[model samples]
Target: MTDRTDETDDTHRPGDQPEQHRVTDGGVTAAPGREGAIPEEDTNVTEVFPEGNLDLRAGADNCYKCTTCDTSCPVAEVDEEFPGPKFQGPEQWRLKRKEDADIDGSIMSCSNCMRCDSACPSDVPLSQMHNEARGEYVDDQMDALSTEYVRNRILSNYRTSAELASKVPQLANFAMNFGPARWVMEKVLGVTKEREFPEFAEQTFREWWRERGGAHVQSSEKRIAYFHGCYSNYNTPEVAKAMVRVFEHFGYEILVPPQKCSGTPMFANGMLDDARRDAETNVENLASAIADGADVIASCTSCSLSLRQEYPELFDIDGVEDVSDNTFEAVEYLRIYEDLEGELADAELDGQSFGYHGPCHARNQGLHRQAVELFRDVDGVRVEDVGDSCSGISGTYGWKEEKYDTSMKIGEEMFEHMKHAEGEAGMTECPTCAMQMEHGTGYDIYHPLELLEDALVD
Candidate 1:
């Protein structure tokens, strides 16, 4: 871990002589009399280094070693290899700073869910540090130019794969399911054949939006651009449709832009450069809509977290602050709308009961009860907080052969709870969690927006 904070700050004093500022990597030029600081005028240049390239200065200094993060880690409860977030994060951070080799491979298991950061009593940025270290470790160990690297890169650049799969849905779905093809994928790409992957849609959400002339919807006092992420656009267009219908019912003029993936899959799989590229494209695409005073909303909680929180925290892309400020999860947006305009349209669900699995990323966003609150507003819908447990399929983490068993193990508790819980169907904010929960318990699962859309009154 390289510490940038140890470098002296160039605070200008009246008597101090101006010094030349050097340009750093990624083309970011610093102002005169400063070190590694971005010029205020150049919004394109970022002062923040890409993930794993920079280290936190005194990041773990606040750690009292109370092990609160350890106790709170959902991953640690399942995998003993992960000595909990404290060991893999704060404690390991200290060891790595002293000696790089002292840090072990256990850090790779971190899902970068930011739960440890949230649970830390001393506010240690544990998850961030662990992610950074994982990057460093992989970079040192793996040959980036190798065939294995290429396969991993392909797996990580999920947007590209999804687009291709969507274009040839049947072939893609068959290839994924076929035994011989699965063996080839496991051998060549390190993707596991044991777990089921979500099938790509023949008609994506954006495709459906274009067919319906979704872009030309009449403008209203309340306006929003739907950031229907890759999963909705590729694998589950129904969820996106439900979101649009529900939003329209509430008098929101919805704008469906052709958007790229939220780059979370890339981030989770250690493909930092790919994630940065996707993030840049999205920020550029949303700039105009955001300037026109439209709130950017996403149905997927992970996508919302990526836009609303991860962009600034991980990439430090220019103009992302504006996007982050404007972005909202669909349910979060609904809650805000209700707060401003009074209760939502009294939608009748006919007394349907559902269990809610708060996605780990959603929980990381401090949205513990907001999903339930949104569901509670629906007439005759029962929404229970099934627990704050993780679904354990953190992005593409569970799809790799090496991680399949551990991923299933991590999700066992959540799966068991859902199996026994009383619910006609499962409700969640994440598409991946919905898939995992369904696979785990064989229950009909849905995003809450889907249910709300079905139950809309008048």
Candidate 2:
């Protein structure tokens, strides 16, 4: 919000004498040689305020009170208490510039689904401003360490929890399903009792790769580095395996690089600092893989979005742009770089029908139609675009106790569409969307990679 843009003093000539001396924030007095001259050390203010680079505050000025974003927001339509993106994003962002501005409690209600970003006609980065504001609000409340804060912290770093739970997955799964444990989580941690937790796999994808001699496979000319995010690594290793199988069939050597969580949950929960750390780690590792003659890809749409878009937009880290340029979603990578349609032309699906619920992040990335088109190209496969509605489970948003009802409410339209749609099952690229779809409608949801993997011939 600070006016970091450099201003030019057009009134003074290049050889004009100094009129007055001014002291800068860095405690350096500028000896006026030219009108616009300032201390060289004060040029980069980001060193003093690292958070300056994380926010798109300047974009807030572009909002012209158009209600396009408001109408498109799924949360705003469902929750009246929540102000739409017009007020919550650019309008609130302007107010946040003041030191004494009161932070709206409703900002926490934002699902961060990013429909506002796509709907804005003025190219305003509405969601980015909201995300930064949420971080400010969370930091302000950290001293109290409220139950909601504690719950957010727990959910934000779900990678750690998943890793620990995966060690003894059966017991972990049992504890989650146990009624008394659920009550304890509900009462103490603010997790909702209505939603069932995702089950951890007995073995992780990395462990399976090592055990099955996948790590020793000879490198092919076409290589891809897989960024199997937390969900695919822990809860649904089968999806990761399906990706591996399909990629190998295309004669591409798979490289599983050392990576961390995609930081989608951290961003959604207003843990910008945590998300920055994740971006730094992932960019370093994925950039290294790219430097080694491999392209980066993720099966999870959120993970791909984090690597390909969020990191560059929210962080000023080295190699972030390079990593972003090279990263692609799994099906997207295949479609762009390989002959996916031609390769799958002969493959048969036996007339399977699927209702495709495009994830919000995928829509934000503008690649939602890629999967739909690819699936439609397959013989005897029916794919339906089951409306562009938010699943309301924006990562960890729906899991919180206070948000459970709101989350379900926001998802009602999508759930209704899925219930009536003629399909063998629901198909999507997001793990959390799959979970929410299954929860809302008593139907099985699967990643498109799993279906494509089964349909492809060896």
Candidate 2 residue lDDT tens string, 156-194: 999999999999999999999898899999999999989
Off by over 4 Å in 1: 1-55, 100-103, 145-148, 339-345, 377-379
Task: Give the per-residue lDDT of model 1 (tens digit) for 303-386.
Answer: 988887667766777788889889988878787665522444444667788888988888877776776876666677788888
TM-score each candidate.
0.83, 0.87
Provide the lDDT at 187 for model 2: 94
| Pairs in steric clash, model 2 | none
Looking at model 2, residue 125 earns an lDDT score of 77
lDDT values for all models: 0.74, 0.83
Error of 1 at 71 (Å): 1.7
What is the alpha-carbon lDDT of model 1 when measured against the actual structure? Answer: 0.74
Query: Which is the leading candidate under lDDT?
Result: 2
Look at candidate 2 and tell me the lDDT of residue 202: 92
* Candidate 1, poorest ten consecutive residues by summed lDDT: 1-10
